[model samples]
Target: MTTSTPAPTEAGLDLVTRLNAYLEDVAATLGIRGESCSVDLTGPVAARMRLNWRLPGFPERDVDLMWHEEHGWSAAVATHSGDGHHVVVAYLGGRTVASQPRLVARFADSLRAGEHQDCWPGPPMLRTAGGPSALAKELAAWA
Candidate 1:
């Protein structure tokens, strides 16, 4: 299986830009109080991509900002991938949920639209329920 690393490229940055704009709009729609939603500056990608590609019922987390009193994050989004940026949502004092509905929809849209690269972990790595892969382990880690 391919590691979750993406190649750094201008195209990847493009995806990140779209994510920033799209998230801004979503935050406005729900009147996201405060700057709860934002693009992470320290993220590996220059910007975050917002594509409607993801499973249903997942919530979006502003990965841009992670807060940990113990760890004390001093920046936004901390994932290191060439895919541009990962949606950063730091609820509950700076923990992240990988399977947020809003985030999934955005990612799924990008995948379906062919705008972003296919970053699925692939086969044994692709997350699924009882599909004989790391899906169970990954999901369990989240729980």
Candidate 2:
């Protein structure tokens, strides 16, 4: 007899749901206001959560929270650049999500304690930046 395995997307959906909730709380704690946050779990490679916010004078910005299957989670700020013609995605932070609940809790704790900022990055972004973020360093140290 042969058995079937569950789709990775099934897991992705559950994780995305929990992550969206976490992001909502994180935004509230940070005092970020505007449209509520939501995660798009339509694809396999990446799940994207987005929220809109505006400062008094500057234009509204879209904050994107992305989860990459292999690379884990990160945040990005999307907005029109100074040239006023181009939109840009400013990289923020990332961390692995091997243990969904554990990682989510860790992120919540860190954010609550001001230990991990949204500007932190995971390994891939660390390589791009030629260095690691504080959270990444901490994660590595413990590993």
List TM-score per model, in order.
0.24, 0.36
lDDT of 1 by residue, 1-143 (tens): 01122553554444444444444544444344324543433333222333222323233322332222122222223345545454332221123223333554454344334443433322121222232122223224322
Give a tens-digit lDDT track for model 2, residues 1-143. Answer: 01122344644444544444545554555444424343333343334444344222334655444544444555444556633132323223344433243454355444334454443443343222111232233233233
Model 2 stretches with alpha carbons more than 4 Å out:
1-13, 33-35, 44-86, 97-143
Candidate 1 residues lying further than 4 Å off, grouped into runs, are 1-8, 40-143
**Per-candidate clashes, comma-separated:** 30, 1
Q: Point to the candidate with the largest TM-score.
A: 2
**RMSD list, candidates in order:** 16.3, 11.0
Question: For each candidate, what is the lDDT?
Answer: 0.33, 0.40
| Global local distance difference test of model 2 | 0.40
Backbone clash total for model 1 is: 30
Q: Candidate 1: minimum summed lDDT over ten consecutive residues — where?
A: 66-75
